[model samples]
Target: MCFLAESKINRIVFLSTVTDSFPKRHKGPSLTSPQRPTMRLASGHVAVQLHGEELTKIQKDFKGFGKGLVRLTPGGWLLPAPYTKFADKIYNTEFRASDVVIMTYPKCGTTWTQEVVWTMRNNPNFNHPKAGIPVKARSPFVDSDMLAHLGKDVLNSELLELVKDIVPHPDPDEGLALQLTANIPDPRTIKTHLPFSLMTPNLLDTAKVIYVARNPKDVVLSFHHHSRLMKSMSYVGSLDQYVDYFINDQLIYGPYWEHLREAWPRRDHPNMHFVFYEDMKADPMAELRKLNQFLGTDLTEEQLEKIAHYTSFEEMKRRDDFYREKEMQRLDQEVSKKDGGFFRKGEAGSWKGHLTDTQEAKINAWTKDNSQKLGITFRYSL
Candidate 1:
């Protein structure tokens, strides 16, 4: 939805790769009840149903998600079925004063920003052995119950080994990522797609939170590709079908407008920092500098330059393994290999290549209708 001249921008770099899979396949029956139950949302979207190949595929691929979706009452936020069990556990997570968290809706530069923030804060030298570890290990995604439920056969040995020594939780439904996030060393860097409303009320008071938002037009396109790429999602729906799900808030962690609106009013909180995907792409150096200041890291210009170089889009792509979950790709070799794996275009406004004019107009109107009162203007074309 937006564009910037890559040649005109100062290059910056970082790394992250999160391909979550269970150690074994779930051969048992679906954890959810057999009957599919549906609920209507405040927006008139069906909370537990999308009624298409998309929902069918999700239900087929992720048996743990009983109905494939579950609606959070009061707010009508739809999440993967595991939320029915993991919600309280996630909400009760402990936060440290020194912790830094990267929060965003899916595919909104969460990994990109995680690498940047993690490198700047924990691996400024870029030589730490931990730097080589996948970001999934370095920065735990607290809301990963969705991925943990994928129950794929290919396990992330790196992650499994990392958490091997930790005592397993009493609840079998608790995600490994949640345990890792809770037990990681201090000054932890965490990631999540959950909105603030679903998080602990003291999150802003307990730790620094960075929220990254992107234009819905680009987010919809990126998420569509991601859904298709992820084996757990196996989305075979058309672009138009996906777009309807996005705008209607039928997708998991959706009500995109509401997600941003939840953070916009809290943008001024001392511990909250807001960033735009377009701004980060347009000038990563500028955004990185802002992050440095917000973090009070006091890193010199030289360090920022080195961090920028290490996290550049080209460098990240070159070192794709460090930023992508390669194990998950084993099942969908053709799509992952053909589409360049998790590190896709990473460009703003790439939606122009795919979205029809009608789709664009519809998304634009939806954005205008929802965001007008929020005062959070998004750049469709940077």
Candidate 2:
């Protein structure tokens, strides 16, 4: 295992301990009620304090995610870093005539959106039996080794391949490293955390996008916890400290407001629509119907019922393989505090259970300002 600095260990341990505190007794609407428009992310409810290196780590990680591929872009706009060597594979892959893009900041609703879209396009009656095929096999990561030979293309050694045997891929083609982006970024439904500036011009020119939004409080709660599980990010500090980085535009593609703004301008172009996870949870059936119409498909009543039945929190937990890779089979041992995998508790309004009121409001304020600056006027109740 790669060893982190001793100080880093202390930082992680401290934050973990704090976030693990007992949950406040829910008083009805606190976790579920809508926050008033005047109530902001920084509403004196949540307070975060972080110092030194832990703060620096987040700044660095964000910079890296932003610059992944943008050094080659003209103005440094959409700099989402793909695996350098495999960048071409993602840009040049064969795309279907009818593919739709699902874009979001990580941990927003990427997977759920995938499920929603898959149901909409392939089986409108998401509740029906056998509504769609296995996901990973069909939804490949454009720049990862599942499709491209990375190092040979960009001159870096292979990374993250240990998980390769666990994740499935759609095409059995030679994982070719060619860049087909001369025409446009390939595949019908590519995933990205890229800002608007760095993305190749062709990506926006030809594709329709479905962008997902989540409360910044929740995003930080989920994302900071996620870093703990991702080996590359094990060194970062607590959610509180991470919030500082987030506010400063120092988290991956963050300044959640800025990264989000990159898409908002295009949200109403007849090819883009923004969906909030909160809204999805509050009215899933309605959202599913809206999604169905957007995808240009219709679902039978039976299929719709089946989808609603299966994608529930209770149902997803019952399944052994919702968002898990086979490698997680080893993680099946007693759950560590880190939770061992990406899917964690996919519940909404989970922020109150962890973040102090001060910190929650602070993040919310940052969220509100950025939301306005960037033109995203969505609600983030919870």
Candidate 3:
């Protein structure tokens, strides 16, 4: 099913299948309100006016459903239970030849990498002193249900205006990624947390994918804090309980081992590149150089240094309001009601402070087992 929205001369299209299942109710805007603009597509899918600030409360309510509300699809992958219907549409989405996909397991420096890549792609000469746009808007999340739910006309009108000169492709109703790709010009930046198994069949052949991996221990700690912060999926359990879920591969987009293993073998593929979060954190400049080389951007030493300066953890945090104001607003509201922001202590080995000796041992053993089993090695401490 597809949703068509009129915004100026551009037509925003959202494609999603109809499903009887809906997320559990919470204290937020009603999806069935008659006053809001609504459309029923030929595929029996219904689109509603659930974009912009209106979704903030609904997102919080959805997060309250907790980790137990995951959806295990027939494709043998897990997704946020509430977003399964959206994921269903993304799973079948198409790919474009000029796409640059940012692939990662959740909380594995997805945002940081995105900033670096987008800057490199659009501002190679460093002529643009400021980003002048949010990172999320610049590189839209391909599998984002928010984008799918809100439609391009609403969520990306600002972004579309920013790059309209560069993106002249025709529109299609395939999915968010395709829609964005069609509008954006060549070498479009796209992000996703989908495991390789669930990705488009021709993605490796058609697009350049930067896959980032991090130590599961750190990923767990960051993810725990992130989960708690995002009201839609906050966890009320102890760190021990959360680690149990991590060790057992029950977290969203987990089986970390399986996800990593599936993609590890494809690392040598010409169009694919694998990066370790630790390496990027350890020497961001070196990683940036590597990225510039891989992405075929002719950035000079000065340009590279400038990119590093702007995208550093401190700078990104300082400029969060500029790059991620909407997300920050949601998280800030969450913090007021709860307590956490998307950009928590961006450090490696942060897990050491939170994990007990026994818990550390458990994570270590699990990591060792999985690393050996998958024929991959990870630097647990930086």
Candidate 4:
């Protein structure tokens, strides 16, 4: 069975924590009900404060991140409150020197990059039966436990069958994804949306890290669609509203510029390989060659060409049935059929079609304010 198809069995969980004292000003809908007590995330010494103004500004129909967002103090990185549950595991995991870690804020060409890296590292021939396994299974997402805290019952029938025989973890706090990732032998390809501050301190020195960044404009659009399909997010907000969340740094794994900035300064580190989504889209073969060099995969030119074609947007879409989780298919069948399903239009600068002039200007201003000092620029169009 493809790990992509099997691993998704437990991937659809999402639940919110109730807060004892919510300032009346910020109370919003809970994940499952309307007008429930405001949700908040608390773990150990840190308690996230609900900003009334931010919550009130949210459209009434919004159901995902609006319920609650937590900021890890000192670093000020934002994530869903439940992240606290698995924070220690994520920050303290033992990384190996042979591991290849792919880091990105969500939807920033992560799947594409994962497919490319996994292909080069594991199955350059495209003939290996293991190569047919989904990238998710081959390169596990470490933060997956955070998304699956709600429990096993929420998973659809297909997923239930896949995970039925797996023994329950002895440590309640240890995430399934983290466990799977830890046991994946040597040269594992690990994926995470967590910023550097949240990962294990020695990660940079211990493992090869590939950081992929996309223009904030396109990230906002792709993330909007992702939220709608993820079930946990259940986002129904308009593109304009989503833009407000993006610019204000309220979305899960947001503060987009900050995420990139964390890696930008370290781009030259021997173990760090920084890539731009636009550059990859423009010239995948060149990017693949560069990646091949960084990974020291030593793929033949023929192998690189084959890997490039296999991971192309059109090809991935051709095999979307294997790529999509059952939950995604059930959440919104129309969305799955309308575009390329989870494999949506893989183009840069498509934000032009969805963002209004005001939204675009606001995002541009937000980008400047956050990224001016980083000395990095993005290509919003091809």
CA lDDT of each prediction against the hidden true structure: 0.71, 0.49, 0.65, 0.70
- lDDT tens digits, residues 1-382, model 2? 1111122232222111122111231111121212211110111111122224533454455322212221121111222233332333344444454667677876887777766676556545345343333443334334333222211232212222322333243222333212211122223355555454434445555566788988777788788766555433342456677766566554544445655756777777776778888888787778877876776667766666667777765565555354344444223233334364566777667777788877878877766666675665555563
Query: What would you estimate as the lDDT of candidate 2?
Result: 0.49
Per-model TM values vs. the true structure: 0.81, 0.64, 0.73, 0.81
> Model 3, 319-370: lDDT tens per residue?
7745455444234365434544677778888877688999899988877876
> What's the C-alpha lDDT at position 54 in model 3?
33
- Which parts of model 1 have CA positions greater than 4 angstroms off? 1-67, 152-158, 165-173, 322-326, 329-331
Query: Candidate 4: lDDT of 283?
Result: 96
Off by over 4 Å in 2: 1-82, 88-96, 123-134, 143-188, 320-325, 329-340
When superposed on Cα atoms, how far off is each prediction in RMSD?
Answer: 12.4, 14.0, 9.1, 7.8
Indicate whether candidate 1 or candidate 3 has the larger lDDT: 1
The local distance difference test score of model 3 is 0.65
Total backbone collisions for each predicted model: 13, 36, 4, 0
Clash count, predicted structure 3:
4
